[model samples]
Target: MVNQAEQIDVPCADAIMRLLERYGFDTIFSIPGVHTVDFYRTFPERGFRHVTPRHEQGAAFMAYGYAFATGRPACCMLITGPGLLNAGTGIAEAYSDSLPMLVLTASNQRAELGVGRGCLHETKSQHAVEQQIAGFSHLVLDTANVAEVLHRSISLFLTARPRPAIIEIPRDLLAAPTRVTLETASMFHPPAPAPEAAKMAADLVAGATRAIAILGGGCRRSADAVLELIERLGIIAVTTNAGKGVVPEDHPLSLGSSLPFEPVRTLLEEADVVLAIGTELGETDLLYTCKPYQIPGKLIRIDIDPHQLTMNFHPSLAILSDAGLAAKEICKHLSASVSGADRADREKIVRDSRAKLVGEWSAEAPKHKAILDVLAGSLDRDALICADSTQLAYTGNHYYPSKTAGAWLFPNGYGTLGSAMPAAIGAKIGCPSRQVVAIVGDGSFLYTLEELATAVENRVGIPIVLWNNRSYGEIKDAMNAGGIPTIGVDLYTPDFVAVARGFGCQAILVESLSQFGAELGKALSRDVPTLLQIDADGPSFAELAN
Candidate 1:
């Protein structure tokens, strides 16, 4: 017979550890500080493997990368004040992108509140920082309510449209003895099906002449449903940059990414009906301009978050539901409602668009011809490519198409400049055998360049392709659109080849299309990690956009 007393007598921290273990979190990444002493001490005792990061920001990014690769949220602990503050950049990235994360921090004791008795790692306002993040909905500030808060917060973190949640542990409470409960209800809640809305969506699709489907990151969680919806409706589907791999780009219906492409912009404006699945269609996706093509035609927007349903452009029908379940329900009704004429027209459009894009790539100019060619030839079906927030992201979306599912990750929601390097590191670690590449601009590369040390030390040898434009190209593009002189946008960069070598990685520099193939091949063949710095013509966006 099992002893009931033995099962219920776990320590508070031990109980928390068991909860994490139940959730399949075996690794905890953090930078130790005075406030988090208990966490550091207890984490090891509770059988959690800890990774001590060189910097708090690096630790958070590492955790973010781990979550991205594993499709599971990772926990990060930071001390009060500076520790938490240092992690702000990466936290903002997770917040913007709806990445699942549990940010644990030590808080000043209640007894020391405003007494002017100096406290270590004290902050006047810690919660103030949490609110600054765009999608930080779940937070826990009281340690007395740790189990209750953990139960609720963990549920929210794993629920649909996952985002980062902050759990502040009081300094005194870490040592306080209390009864630890091991019982935790399952936090996973699948998005419920919306049969009625799906039927309505089907009817709307049946009536359209020219139709397009815009898939978002939320929809990517249900790639099968997205693919089924596409196959049934036979619509020309284009994903937002973040939603790139929801449907394979090689599919006839897949119109690649809709990130600031003039052709896509024109198509969206002319379409009769647009089905937006699980995407908020943020300002960045729309090139920060939503004048005429915001909602091109009859807009049918389905999202789990109700706040995302409203439109700067008009939305005809708004359905608030889970993306996957909604797509599944819509697929059920699509077969009967979709007519032969609609299917024929959609197929014809996709075929024509594919031919046009292919022809353009074949006849590309001296500048873009090389980068595109290398990407086209080297990118494997199973390879995962991560792009930073730069013109490189737009180019990758336009040119590179993944063969398998979850083969591409980008910093879309947060649009953080330095995300690709660390994210690529995480993705490589997540799938060590598969090829993982970080495509970054000079400015973005500089943001977390120090992470190269992390990569070298950890023996994570992923290829990094530097688009050496020597300028903040995205800002320059934005400035040109606004008719402003490019000030504070231009940048000076070091020789990435030398930088890569200094970090103990093989380095190559390619100036023309001719050198691309050789350099890329060499980089991939190397046993150790390599960096291929392509000093392509400045401002490729202007040429590519045209």
Candidate 2:
């Protein structure tokens, strides 16, 4: 606990860094401005690795990618209103994905707050505006309250449902000395499942004739525990897009992220019991499907957020606990009571569901699958794919075979454009040893394409596979399907290879599917970014597949 009676000469800005250091922050993404420079006074001595993004949006997205890749929050320093507002979309994306981030931004001087006196870089209410997207947005009125407010914000990121915590510091207080005693960082454990709840869930699983498991993003850290339980019970498993790679796609009982597919949805309705872990079972998870998501049988849901237990689909039994802890508890109670005699039957079910999903694919799916096949064969087993909301990525969402958890990064919830390139750069910085690739559409690629300069400046080696379809293909298709005229879907795209070279990155125009593997190989060897543009008109993936 902090004692207000004790005083110190340390500036509030420096105090923040001191506490963040104790909290284990090693990297910061920001663009320094006059209002925020006070926080940088002893930046070099503090030894925090700083990354400067071209735009504030990139800063937030970079932090998001860092957290998503490493499963830990990263810090972002922003200027007053515009900087924070520009980063709003990225922050919202993080919140939607349930990723943790610490956002520190300068607000107007205490005297000018909400005055509408036309102060420079001022907003009417930064706090209220940010509260819509962030988990909580706090404005510090007194320097004495800074430490306690920070502790409260950070605790949520660590011990509860993870989301962005916005701390708005008044510029005038940045250099002010505070007497508040800083508290040493303390760790808090996530809540575990109740003994009764665990036993009830285990009993349901043990008694089911046909049971299945659905994993969500919340299971990223609990993959091993969840896999153990799934194997122990010999049950088929499917994953949402955000939960891809929770179980290796090659596993015999795995259904390869096919939750939204018609066949998988049908199978879920047929089961006698369904175990859902760490998922909202939201409509976004069932994207492109016409049928409303339903759970007709007994549904057992395990989640950290109590409110989420009944959000979309009601559960017969709900356990409010951390995904990993609940999974372990369920496994502990299950023991060796589950017989393995039915393991072969579960494997056959997975195979049949997958085959039916393939049979129901639209004409365009096979085209994207050919390209995905090439990518799957070329990348390393531990490689991470930072994907954008494009036609190719939309297909890969259900089809990509991820080898490990946290290996596939996509804007599934927020559905933002232009996150893949900057996110790939951030992922590389966070995990320098792992291979990172960005698969983006021509339209979305333009969103953060300028981040290529950052990649080159930092000497971060990453391959950006530009899927140039010459238009907003998905939207145009949607319009056509709805009997609407396509208007703004067609775009005049630039020569990406030439633009990339102008930015000092290695660039090439991939002429055919056969040439991509060689170019990607070369890209992986360089210490800077490589742009490989595959034109939609150049060759047909359907023809290649045939």
Candidate 3:
């Protein structure tokens, strides 16, 4: 393989590396298979620091975590068929949460089509799995014009509302030579401002007595704009789990996260007008379900993608614009609409929300309270936390608070299980100096338990805090709600302490509240990777709901 710096017309793999360099992707996480020979060979020449994951899924999740931490898409590569199959969960997580990522895979030659000859690692269709994920993906197939496809694919992947996209290069395409022009810059463009759209939003806020802003994934990208908008309009703001830390939770007008909480529902019901910014208000964020067209107030929605405007809830006004730019413009127009008294009232609301949250955490039982307290104390103010799906997602989003934008990352869109471990590994790799933590539930942890080895191999050293409740807590709650007994959701698992030790990382199992502080302190202070497993003392969601 020719070096990336040497401007030689080469195969699709070489061209892809050139494109990656142009996009400033210096690190790549992958689990190479026989199908990706050319990509593996070209990585070193391209000056990419490649981390070989133990599983393809681990690679994908790691890329997702890295993107969340650094606000830049990380590249992932896998072989076709089984490789792509294993990577499905990570790709889905990236898709659902709008994480920017490039997934490159090698497919069998076009000549090998449908010949029940059954080639090694062959699938019925290379692109089928991606199609299943299409609702959340921006996929592209590269059958011809590899360079052009690569350019366009990268462009779409970087656009506002960025999501995972695939470029399937066939075996023959990698072996064939092609004319290549060195790209001086990435083909992708930065999102532009939406001033006109922002003014309209400002007008809607001006006419309302009680306006509430619901921040989602898109708002995280423009935290400064959101903060400015809140300051200007003096409106109460609440974040969905994915949108946590878009603005400081401790900020006067910020209501923290509102998922799985009765207070948030009450607040929404009381508002005269609801401004949903950058979030789709999806099913999971709305407690697994919500009544359509039943919101008590006018709904004004703003998002970078037009498709998200009317989902779940109808909107009085919908605007397609970049979140940050829209927020900035709205702030600019809100100067005349907000009075001094209104600002004071908004501040009071924020105070009340904070006081309420503080009260809840303080009143929690010893075990759950210990987990929350240890996490808050151990995590650096600027450290990044990547939470997995299910109970961990709910608990972390509600209890933990982050100080900066992109500091709290999680899989919110698809609500896929088992994202925390791999994502934490990726985030650690992306920002090696910052302390990264993954909060995961037992059910979610089982989905990607093998990635623990990848973390050890790469020395990514992220502390994984497993909230071991010994059951699929969320599903149990649902079953109980429907008057069914908890059956399939409960599982007896191996001690996570032993599991972490077997994987050669520091491990601790804390069952008592008294042991919480020591275990957390040791885990966070360690130079090597650590896993702190805590046995949560509480009724399963089933018991609580029943």
Candidate 4:
């Protein structure tokens, strides 16, 4: 409870805390340093939970995970130069995946910013360096504009395309005792669809004999609208990795998030009208395929960003609106024209595509499928699975079927290594009631392995499925496929189970595929995180799968 006496006049840093509370920011992830220690001046008064990670990168990734899982932005407080620099990679990954985050850092004093008097944590121009990663970076010069600037950042996250926003605060203003006005956070609505464009798209979709809809990350909030539109139009649907569970994979009209596969590409080639919503048809969405996407159809694109409307693929009808609003507008115009006759044919196409894709994946990577199947069956409907940029996650991006939106989180665009463990910890922190797990590769797990102590200290009961291939398996495969000599792919590996045990986590080495389910169940009920190590070249997974 905030003291009534102290509310009259407090430190400038404490004033910022009150504003953050008004904006509904209740949690912060940080590793406090001398420069920014004052930022935590009123944590006890404001009732904000502070999670401290070993490194600044872990802090940023944790913020990303919290935001991705709950669809709300989290705050990160860091020191000056090196602290901000350490967090760049995670911020960039958040930008690539369109996650909402607010990063606050201490900068050198305004007088010492570019003067280079060799202050403790001085840099040439910290805000300039950070501008490249965050959606926008601002150097706060005065205490008066703090409320307005923070309001802008929160508004962008709620109403526009979500991305990380950075605020660089000078050290002098942090501790100054001053009075600042706190404004109420307003409700900002997203843009609505244009009627003419919606009508034109409805006509094109209604006239097409064969059509398909591709859902992307932008459709996450509008899953209900997306489901309604697809069911009304009676067309087959697919998703990009980011849009994994927008349309449940178990649905008959759903083709899963298999955009990179040949079967989906073939379907896209034959489509007469393509409705691409909330996703950029970027190369990352169609991984492993050198063949360019050929869309001879009339493409209708709906997105909030105007610049993205003409990117990569040209759209016949481009509507600038929120994905959910645009979908509802299109469906309003489409109800009379579409019939129920084509749904059965579309379902058959999805089934055939699934069969062909299963045959291909089973032949190429049976172990990954076998592992994913077990995980899918073991978890609850609301379980959050955080994946890293590893071979197993690459396969699961398409092969795994998620039943709910926001359930599957992956670092697809930036493709960063060692993200799964920290991200899963953040997810668990954000939604304590739901089950959370991390699926990471041996090569990527080492990137942030020190975070195991953070999980153990916080008692985040997360299950980490470590795929121990003992090398950079995906890079080696790519080099072999290209007939290039393998060079830096192989490396020495350590005993991960022992390492995890040393960090006070439950650890186990699975000898066979059959033991996975029982161990995972045990891990979920424990007080600390668990590390389950599985060898990629171990006992045959095909035998159990068959």
**lDDT per model, in order?**
0.71, 0.87, 0.74, 0.86
> What would the per-residue lDDT of candidate 2 be over residues 227-263, giving only the tens digit for each residue?
8888777788888888998988999989988877887
lDDT for model 3 comes to: 0.74
lDDT of 3 by residue, 463-484 (tens): 7878887888878877988999
Per-candidate TM equals 0.87, 0.97, 0.90, 0.96
RMSD of each predicted structure:
4.1, 1.9, 4.2, 2.7
For candidate 3, list the clashing residue pairs, or say none.
none
**In candidate 3, residue 163 scores what lDDT?**
80
Model 1 agreement with the true structure over 83-140: per-residue lDDT tens digits: 8888888888887777788887777776764455678877777767766862453333
lDDT of 2 at 27: 90
**Model 2 local distance difference test score:** 0.87
Worst 10 residues of 4 by lDDT: 1-10
Candidate 2 deviant stretches above 4 angstroms: 1-8, 180-184, 539-546
lDDT (C-alpha) at residue 258 in model 1: 46
Q: Which regions of candidate 4 fall more than 4 Å away from where they truly are?
A: 1-9, 358-364, 539-546
The numbered model that scores best in TM-score is 2
Candidate 1 vs. true structure, TM-score? 0.87
Task: Find the 10 residues in a row with the least total lDDT in model 3.
Answer: 358-367
The sequence of per-residue lDDT tens digits that candidate 4 reaches over residues 1-546 is 222232346776888788789878988999999999898777799989999999999998999899988888988888999999898888889999999899999998888879989999888999888889988678989877776788789888877888899988899989877665544557778899888889888888988988999999999988999888888888789999999989999999999898878888889999999999999888888774444577888899998878889999999989998999998998889757355567777888999998888434533366777788989999998799999887778788888889988889999789889888999988899998889999999999999999998899898999999988888988888899899999999978899999999999999988666788899999999879999898876675455344
